[model samples]
Target: MSRDCTDYRDIFLNDRPMMDARAPIEFAHGAFPGVVNLPLMNDREREQVGTCYKQHGQQAAIALGERLVSAEVREQRIQGWVEFARAHPDGYLYCFRGGLRSQIVQQWIKEEGGIDYPRVGGGYKAMRTFLLETIDHAVAECDMVLLGGMTGTGKTELLVQLSNGLDLEGHANHRGSSFGKRATGQPTNIDFENRLAVDVLKKRVGGIQQFVLEDESRVVGSCALPLPLYRGMQVAPMVWLEDSLEQRVERILQDYVINLHAEFVAVHGEQGFALYAERLIASLNNIQRRLGGERHQRMFLQMEEALVEQARSGSVEQFRDWISVLLREYYDPMYAFQREKKGGRIEFAGERGAVLEYLRERVNQRV
Candidate 1:
């Protein structure tokens, strides 16, 4: 008796391992979570077959593919599948669609004395459909509360501190900035979204009333937010955080020291002192422009000097003060304008810890 392909969906939702028989490039675009790539054809070979199909027709392409994959090569591929299946007996497999490639692989596995592995019903296309549908459903049902604030109000820190809520940036292993990629490298979009969906689903199952997320543009690094989620965030109630310039700057400096110290040293070398000073000045240059002309240049140079002194002395306080001053004079006013435009919907404002405690209390009261 033949096993049903539809059962693969259950396997996927359960976080069981799976394999993609499509080319690597195809898998990279999007794939189910936990799906390993064991392509029947590599990128170049896939490209050649595609070209043949377009130019010489399907028959020619099929013939060429057969010639390319000899019996011994096919056996070796089957052996690899056998090993993986032995390791994960309940594993799932997929291809571009429930097409010839997957059927061939599936038959080979069964013939090789490997346990029957379920194939995705409609293959990767079906999985993609499911993911998009799930995202849409989540967007519709949840109340999204965006955590909006100036650069260093400890928004990310507060999210981490919260026992409830999704941390999209943390899951991405990014700070959601130009300088946010991990030293290891970023995950593929499929992988990132898979992790995000799993986290969100878990929270929803645990009866989370609302998701607390940082205010981010549609795209974070290379990954794009689902359109529905982004749209919902735009209209949702926003909790803006405010802090004293002294506190905010101290927080920013501490974050850099804790998170990016090694990265800074790696990029700038042992005498990273001068390099960090320059970077700080460059960061303040944007604010300097708002300050205008000679005043901008003066503040710019002063901030640079302060940073240099701090770096030399191994004291971040002075540099933090310098940035706090810039933020007070520059970024805060912009934030004020935005807040006024947002009007009464700005539900709360205070230090991160205080705001989180207040929100948690309010939520508990409602419960």
Candidate 2:
């Protein structure tokens, strides 16, 4: 029987069972949800076949592959497929392009008097096409909202607390900061997009009328945000977090100090600690030497001293007040310009806890 099939769109959306016959690595990066991996060839063998194909052409590659696929090996693979098929009786199978790999497996099943194993029409490529097309359509239609703030205003924390919305940063396993690399390592761009797509699908299913996301640059580490999603975020409504410097610094230290210290040491070592201590001093020195050295240095020294005291005290209220003053004198003006440039459709400015609560209420009302 012909093994030609078209696509897995109906199967995936309708929850029809499916299995993948691609190698583990291919499936690892991205695969249709619920699709089981029943690879026809293992990693080393696949690589060897590819090398042969490149060096000696398709006929030679096929001959070498056939030699490699001993009867015993084929039986072992067929047995595994039989077990999987028995477990998922209605399951269909697919390979790279509804091609040889899938045909080999499907034919084996039929010969064994197993259940019919229809191949996905275009196989993995078709599924990928559907994912890309669906993602593009969703991006155009979805209402995206950006959650923007300075370094440590609990933007990510608040994103988690929000009852309604998607958490792109969390999905990426990143904090959306300069120091946001995951301890578990980052996902590939395709993996990241696949995760994002799954999140979007879940939100849509849950009746999410709009998405809330952080205002991020186009790239997050090695992963690039899709153009459509990025554009939606750019034009979407925004909520800027405004927190006092003392609060901001305290929050930053709390978020970063424990989780990031090892990474910082790896990157900057002992010198990093000294630099951390002297950053304000260095900035003050530069200002004093050029613009208004004396006054700037004095202010810097005071701020530096206050920071040290706050660190020593570990008092949340004290840190909050300190960050509040810093925001008024320092972070506010800088953020003002950025907000004006952003010109977001909506703006909610206040303390982190209060702002998040208000935003959550608003989102709930809308929903």
Candidate 3:
């Protein structure tokens, strides 16, 4: 075999494990799912090499890089590559452009470790381009639906139950609302886009000619939707989810207050509640201008008192007061306006089970 794989669709569809040979900063900015960064050069070393290349030429930079990663450092890096190669025999490795850096790694792995591990042809740049194209292609070719609902009508909950459902919020690691932030920070925009592209590609490859996505703003948290997909969503058919106000309140309580606090506790351990309280207060404060001073202060007081009560007595009952008010006064009206605007596109409107059944049937109709 040539051992230089360029089949981007198959690579992503199979969820192939990948070793990213880019610098740490490069990987941090964006990388595919199931990829592990095992950089041939750290950020400092890569910077030094880039400077040398610009000042002295390619030969001089190559000499400098060899000098920088000699002996002990070279052996250590090779050892990691060997371990990864042994573990994922079918996996591939790549640098930013499948050029000198990856070739060097491949050569070293063979010379030192007696393994002929394959490298991804054209590397990260090419794979990323393929994924971007995947999203655009799906936007052009596939039948898409947008699931919309008032706050806490369980749109996301119903979305996950379908084979063709595309959970945009899950991919963005955000809930797509003011209180949507999680304990951990979101991925970089590039990372989020890459993840979403891979998902669309894999689903399409699995024979899904249609996809059901949440009706989202152009931006989800800090991650912006691909322009093609966003534009498609603008004209796509919509399914409006509905629920009783009492049920919506309970769902919000579980997802935003109880579950979100537990998530913070899990991530931050001893300081979880403190950080969770700060996040909640900050989230509310973010909307202070819109909520107006009087309403904001009233809700803020309710939130603060609720937080205090929860801290002291583990009583979350008080949180319902603020959550219900915010839903009724803030979220409901805004979403009602959205529903009216999207009324022409609303193909079906129903409660959770009904909406889920309709979406499933829509997906089936496309088959």
Q: Which candidate leads in TM-score?
A: 3
lDDT measured at residue 231 in model 3 versus the true structure, 0 to 100: 94
**Positional deviation of residue 281's Cα in model 2 after best superposition, in angstroms:** 20
1-367, model 2: which lDDT tens digit per residue?
6445564454655566777899888887777656789898888888998899999998898788789989999888888887887777666888888777888788887787465667787788877776676668777776667888776777887887765556777767776654455444667677677667766665666677667788888987667888888877777878877776666777755654434444544657766544444543443354354335555555565656655764577333333443344445455666677778886465676777777787777666773
RMSD of 3: 1.1
Name the regions of candidate 1 deviating beyond 4 angstroms: 1-4, 7-9, 55-59, 70-73, 178-184, 188-191, 263-322, 365-367
Q: RMSD in angstroms, candidate 2?
A: 7.1
Deviation of model 3 at 307, angstroms? 0.6
lDDT of every model, 2 decimals: 0.72, 0.69, 0.92
Candidate 2 structure, TM-score to reference? 0.69
lDDT of 1 by residue, 223-311 (tens): 77778888888898888887776677777666554345556677667855555555555555644556787767766666666666665
Give the least accurate 10-residue stretch of model 3, judged by summed lDDT.
358-367
How many backbone collisions does model 2 have? 12
Work out the TM-score per prediction.
0.81, 0.69, 0.98
Highest lDDT among the candidates is held by which one? 3
Q: Evaluate model 1: give its lDDT.
A: 0.72
lDDT for each residue of candidate 3 in 1-367, tens digit (9 for 90 to 100): 2279999988998888899999999999999987999999999999999999999999999999999987998889999998998899889999999988999888888888788999999999999999999999999999999999999988888888888889999999999999999998998999899999988887888899999999999999999999999999999999899999999999999999999999999999999999999999999999999999999999999999999999999999999999999999999999999989889999899988888888877777774
Clashes of each: 0, 12, 0
